[model samples]
Target: MDVDGRNSTIGYGASASGMTDFSRTDAERANPGHDTRQSFQGDGMRGRVLAIALTLATLIGALPVAGSLWVAWGSANRARTDMLDGAVHEMLARYNRMSTEIDQVFDDLSSLPLAEACEPVGLMRLRTAAYFSRGVREVAVIENGRILCTGAGKSDMPASLPLPDMSEGDVRIWYDRVPPDVRAPASDVARSTVIARNGFALFLDTEQIYDLVLTDPRTVLSMVSLTSRQVMGVRSRPERAMLSDMVDRFRTDPPPRSLRVGNRLIVAAPTADGAAMALAAQPIDVVLEAWRQQAVPLGLLGLTSGAIIFWLILTLARRGDTMGARIRRGLARGEFRVVYQPIVRLSDGACLGGEALVRWQQRDGTMISPDRFIPVAEAEGLIERLTDQIIEHVFADIGKFLAERPTVWIAINLSAPDVESDRVRGRLDRLRKTHGVAADQIVLEATERTLIDARRAQSSMRSFRDAGYRLTIDDFGTGYSSLAYLATLPVDGLKLDKTFVDSIGSGTPADDVMGHILSLAATLGLDVAAEGIEHGAQADYLIARGVTYGQGWLFARAMEAETFGAYVDGRMAVAGPPSRRRRA
Candidate 1:
């Protein structure tokens, strides 16, 4: 031992100076030009050997990776083009089918006698015809831009029709504004066209084609006039201007081979009716997703490509460190506060306990959950200090209120170290005595991870019970909880994990697991309290199955101690008591 009472390893001082031998040797070699022909020749051979090895490696490794990437790059483009082409074709095909169906309906309607279309009985026939036709909202008869009559429950047709100047026997599509006098029909489908017969024209519904054809919100299908180049119908609201731009630009100059804007691309194909080009603007993200599956093979090109996993680990470490810093700062600044989530008897909603949940409330009125920061605290060795901070505030804030409601338990969670630590019993005992509250009113929630040393855990839990504090195995069934642990641990109740509770009655395998857990708890004669009972059905399911207590948003969220008092008051006013249901 040194004079300062520090122990020193043998030869520790020698290592500090002896590490400089190579520097002194190099200094000696450089002095006065000491000849080094043999050394130089050896180094030259080594340099050549290293260079040759690196060159061969570069040739072998770079070629395959580069070639693979190049192939993937081309495949990605081809796949992207194919994906967009498929979307465009799908749009065109849908509109074409709608047109074909409408044209068939038009063929049937045009052959009707013009006199019959203008009669009241003929109007009933017209209304019935409009009902049978697909995508037809209302039918009207027109004679040389003059409104004649419509189907039943007549909507005023436009006095002057703006028909696209189509040559005789030629059909065209164009946009026409709906008149304000039109009334909405029962059926939602719409198709409008002026079919000339003799001197009169038949007007059919038009606007509902966008719904019949387009399901995608991003892609737009526009019907453009062949000669006048007017926009007839647009499927999507956002892509309406893009379609107009394409039409205006395509008319002024030769059409651009590719029409793309930022991450959105425009794909156009000739419509089935040959009257318009079906142009659609789709996000490039769709193309990227289609091609992502093909580039996965490039991962096999590098034998040591496992570094991404290491990089991920490092990234997570950095994030943990950032979160750790925030927790440490929070401890200093007192940014965390304890909120109480109500635990109630399942049969009726009565406040039996309040679970202490820590929340980080920033000054800007945003809350960060304990789940995000608790694991970070545990990993960073700051859990004990964090818990201490919360408990101290709780005692200062609500020790008197808890003493008044002696039957209502205030549950606080503990870490693995807390269960085995020497100071826990002393601190808890002191707190209980100081608050003048019985230990039964203090429920310590713990998870299976706290049973690091089973014997020590059992001892600590027994000590807690002897002091009159209730014990709960929190987040039960999530970790190392098993029959052995349950049989051995000295806990009063099992708090069902939220994951299982969320899945209750969902018909998942979790429902079966819940039954198993309940059955096991019953056999062991343990009280069962289920957390995260968000739905009424979940609470009813547990209550019918004899769960002792329930805690979740279905009843109330965690609140301040004063708020909890108000909540309890409200509950007592409605429900009878925490022990049992009141017979009405």
Candidate 2:
């Protein structure tokens, strides 16, 4: 019975142990279906949280980024559009100004009686007008294919005037007179249309209108143009584009409440009944360029901030400092000096005077030429002070020289601004009194370029001369020396420009031209002084041909006060061959 029971127990135990399967039960408990579903749900929740965080970040960053970009792009585009539009508008404004000026000129011309137009008084008036209107290359009154009158350079055009074809419309709107080449057919001869009273026209060259309009920077300004759509007479590529775009966009439809081209914004108006359009372009590019340049500073500030931030974060930034302050401080120390160059008489080799030339000495003792700093000084308004200092020094030197030699003359080349200022005259008067120097002992050499206002110059010079001061016209032949003005002006002498003197006997036509000028000056009783006579031959030639005086290297280069004094004292000798001298 015990054996049977033991065997049954063993069998039961074995079966129970085998059926239990502890590892399989543990696996089933750990991975129950409900638990698996809950695990998958947890993982999905985490993934959704990550995606939400990423999407939130993108939204946070991209909104302002896109908005700012849109605002910037829109502003830039508007500014660009405004600039282009403004360019056209400004061009039109310039055209209007030019047109007004032209009308005024015509009015002035017409106001003159027909009889006076050809007289000397008329010529004087015309020449005065021409001088004031220097931009006008030429002026002519053409009547029936013949030039009725001209101020200057009239022979360059055809002797016989040519009339233009005017089938399209009245050509008088564009031209004052017609050339003979474009004269209308005898059968098509219409009665001359009076454009501006005395300003009448028989025909107009459409080509000349285009040429005139295109020459001005304000008209067909520097711009890109589309060749295909260009008007018949419009030569400017940019103008063509502007005109085409304007016509295409604004011709049919009224202008928008506001329009922009480039950076300029402007108002538009229709022109010429139904055929033409006009727009005014204001200078928006300047403003835009300024704004754009400002961004550089802002960007630099941003970079500096970023660098500071980076330094704060990484602890690896350098100190922010520069040498500009030190350099400025050095400049404030006043380390500038002046040198003098003597001007002398050519005939007697007499030291007449000197021009004070300034120099800048750096802290390191390196001297900088006046040409570099003089412009800077002028722009900064420091030139007046500089000039005063130079004048004081010069007057002191002159006083010292005159203490021994009273007959010597000193010429000072004054800047245009100085010459224009009343203070300069006052200073000269004070200097004359202080130095006991007669006004004739000091010569003021002024250039024609500096004489911008003839009336003012005439008045100023007359006053100076009346005060016993001598005035010399310097660089005489270089500019538009009008014969009419030269004949009328009370200038004591003319300084023939170095360019003309240099060109003399160079086998160029200019030599004969200069000879004619010399003759003209002699006839007018004006003293002629030849300038830049570097060669003895040139000086001899000038003196032989009645050139009264000369200044050049042939006699001497500009020298120091001591050397010049020695030359005046007959100690330093000039090594040139004797020149044929003439009296002034």
Candidate 3:
């Protein structure tokens, strides 16, 4: 039979039998062509079946391979995030621990009697030297651009060391770049010392901090006068080198503010004294070099796993999958709202103005505390928007309140970052204009930390004052630079920190401290507002002490606008001693 004829015959039976059978024995015997044709047909069928099986097997394997790959990629990303978070947390912990240590050291130094530390005779010098001599590289008494005496081991000192007429920048350059001959060693580290003056007397006993240059081990302490722009004393070469490097780095990038450079971290913070000091630490670059050293094996494993994951996901997606996307959209869509806390006169309980507090309401109807999100918002650059929204709400609330009552001043708390920005002043100006409100009607409450840069703070405060806005130093007693800041900054009012009020009349030594603070504010001729006043006795005590304003749950808790309006209409009266409630 011919090939075409045979195929035509087989085609008819192939549909029903799903097979082909050769029954012509004579033809098979005459030609081996029949067997060859049958063999070729059998091979073709097997090949097709093998191809289909291989393709299906490949797809099945790819699903798990893709899934594994995706999982691996996610794991790698998560690991990196965890590592970075751990590093930041560790750094913060170390920074806090160092701060505590410094505080303890300052406390010890402050506890010493000033009379003993600054005796007219050399006894004070001897005592100072003796106190720090064991680990001290040098000790010098600096007063009015002159070094009175030195405990430096070198013979380079004159009877009286008159400071060189150099600018602060010049001094820093000289100190940082000078040869080791002038610098101190690790064993006898050189430090620059200066006495900070408060009015006429040196403020030594009041937790006053002095600038010191020390070795990496923190052994040798040197003092410098930033005002005088000169080194007061010297010590060993190795110590001086380390101290100079530290001082230079500090001048460039100071503490609380951290800058990362390659594998090293440099941090600088201002001394209780005027000088800026810095510390540097180098962390091993394990993450960056991980790929070259150990990443091949890990990456191969991750890649294989990731491939499996990718395939699994692709299969699931192909099978018609449903997935949800979760994202955190911040306070952009009216998630943040304002709550008003009334600031009232302690004597009459007359509500002067309400401070606008921000509250975040989540989609789930849960209210997130300001303490949690405010910092995050600030970090995320959402503070500017947040501030604007707050100002708008405050002004609107003020407008409503003013329609019913006489003009009242509203104080709004600003973050240090916001207050420090030049744009803040402009924003405030615009807000004032938009609301048709006078600057006096709105008080900006900034903490001492907000005024870290004295020059900038002075400039900003002056601008606010010139614009006719009231500025209050918020949480006054809690800051390190409160008293010194009050003397310098242009502020109209002082808001006593809550800690002081909470501790009042507890019959503890802290009460005496609080009383002194109240007296101090009164002496300064600044208006005082006792914040967080909870008890009647505390309120009465504060009122007697001439605190003009008070806030907290003592008189009334923070209420809604309607409730506050009613309270104001009723003019809730507070009975107290006239002395305590005296208005400024």
Candidate 4:
């Protein structure tokens, strides 16, 4: 059989028994065959193997993403929570700390008694107050709108930025916009009290306000005055005015407490004085980027899985024999024979091995594909028998070649039913012993479904692993449940489904998913064999990305066992001297 599903003349049984040797030596031709065997039919898919494969892929992509994300998110949330709480706590602490520090100054200014209209003693009292309240930049006496003597001498207050008319308030805040620095954009504030149209003012640092609000380096904060429509510690005057309007609107209707201001999360917390608001702003994209990184392959899982199952279901729906009794009879008549697809090592294109695929050439001339019959065998309790026939015929065809070139291997597929029932192990042990083939000379293939069911058939799947046979997950990344299977299953390698190999370098949506699958397989320390590679570019991509082996039309298609043997023998002859020298 060739890749086009065409028949070919190979080694023996071209008509009598449908068996074509995978590998044959001339000496075996002279001897009568040990057993003249058989015919069989099979189709596939149950136990949700593909579904489990996908579940595992998603979980792999999700874990680092989810873990990094959850940790980053949870850490960010915790940091935000702590900073907001700290900002509030420090805001109140400053209010109290300043209150205690300035209380004596406020009392002294209020009680110093009105020094008679610009009296020199007024200057003396101003000096005394300034000395007591170091927070005060200057002390001033204002009598009937005339600036009296102050702590620094005759006063000339900037008339343009004059203090607003004061009224009754315990502690008043007003900006002294005198001698502004254009480069710095900073302003000073004066705290004052009035006595009978005359007042004494004390100046304080405005940066103290800036420090009180902006608590964390990653965030910005602003305090807006509801009564005056003024904002302190904000960057621009217009921004202050805009924030004032927002704060005013918010106070009237304060539901939906947080607002977005250009990628930043703006949250408002009212101050202790009830006269102002404290707004904290942080970017939301920090968490969004984290989620996006992990979600790169999320869409591929659904699209690929649907395509796989839909094709399988459509294939399974076709008319074919699925019963055990029929398969038993078919096995006896030799209706089934083995075809081999050469597994090529990506590094050097060497023939690593071949996977044995069963093809049923029914007597009526209707060829039943494996997809049409394997599932029915499993559901009908005939998978074990089908496997037995496949194993026996595959080794029979390849037996003599393997005996000569002991290093060469052949892989055969087994299912969950084969593993769960222990029938596969018994047959393999007996056959390998009879053929005198080392355990390493044969590879046992199973889907993730087998490993997941392996717990039940532990003795079977484990026996394959323990006895040195390479066990692989067939059609990997096609389903959603193999995550747990990877950790617990005693498998040795992963066979990437054709879908991933097909999408290689197409710039298709599945590209990222394929990269992720390859990365995950590597991370698990499993060697990967890519299936369905049909293009040079695809082969190049998989090889560059660390694929160990590949099987597809890109190399040679599935062929009769005899053709595969010839191919392998030829390759070996070409590389034989150097290989032998290296071994020597």
lDDT of each: 0.59, 0.48, 0.48, 0.57
* Per-residue lDDT over 1-584 for candidate 4, one digit per residue giving the tens place of the 0 to 100 score: 22221222222111111211122212223332411222333333423434554555554444444454455555555555456555644554444334443554555567666654136666676665555442445566555444455665554552222455333463335543332112343433332222222366555544444454343355666656667656544422325444744675557644335565556656666665666666666666644654455445443433454456455543443333235545665677788887788887877888867888777665654455443345556556666677778888877898877767776788887766665555666777777777777777777766543443334555666776666676777766553232323545666677776767767768896777778667766767777887777778888888899888888777876778789999987665223211200100
**Per-model TM-score on C-alpha atoms:** 0.44, 0.55, 0.54, 0.44
lDDT winner: 1
Residue range 1-584, candidate 2, lDDT tens digits: 00100100112112210110001112222443321111112244345644554554444333443454444445654664555455445444333334444554565566777566656776676655554432333345555555555564234454553443222333333223333333676445322212222523222122222332221243233211122222322323333444555545554465563455554443344432333344444345544554565555444433343334343422211211122222233245655334444444555555555444444445544443332344445444555565566567667655667545556666665555666576667888898788787767676767655553444567677777677766666666554334334554556776676767778679787776687678767777776776666777777778777776666556654444666666656622243212212122
For model 4, what is the C-alpha lDDT against the true structure?
0.57
Position 514, candidate 4: lDDT: 71
Candidate 3 lDDT tens digits, 32-55: 343221111224434554455456
Regions of candidate 2 where Cα sits further than 4 Å from its true position: 1-219, 222-351, 354-356, 480-484, 487-489, 509-513, 571-584
CA displacement after TM-score superposition, residue 243 of candidate 4 (Å): 56
Residue range 1-584, candidate 1, lDDT tens digits? 01001111122212211110000112222342331111112234345644554554444444455565666666766655555466556556555544544554556666778777767776776675555454455566666656577675334554666665554464433345453235686243343545544433445454444443333456554556655555656665435466556665544334553466667666666665566665565676665654566556653553333454345443443332356766786788798777676778877677776777666654444344443456667767788787787677777767888777666667777777677675666777787789887777787877654652455577877887777677777766654223334656777778776777778768898787788778878777778988777788888888888898887767876677799878776665343223312110
Query: Where is model 1 poorest over a 10-residue stretch in terms of lDDT?
Result: 16-25
How well does candidate 1 score on lDDT at residue 368? Answer: 47
TM-score of 4: 0.44
Residue 162 error, candidate 1, Å? 97
Name the lDDT of candidate 3: 0.48
Model 1: CA > 4 A from native? 1-321, 362-367, 572-584
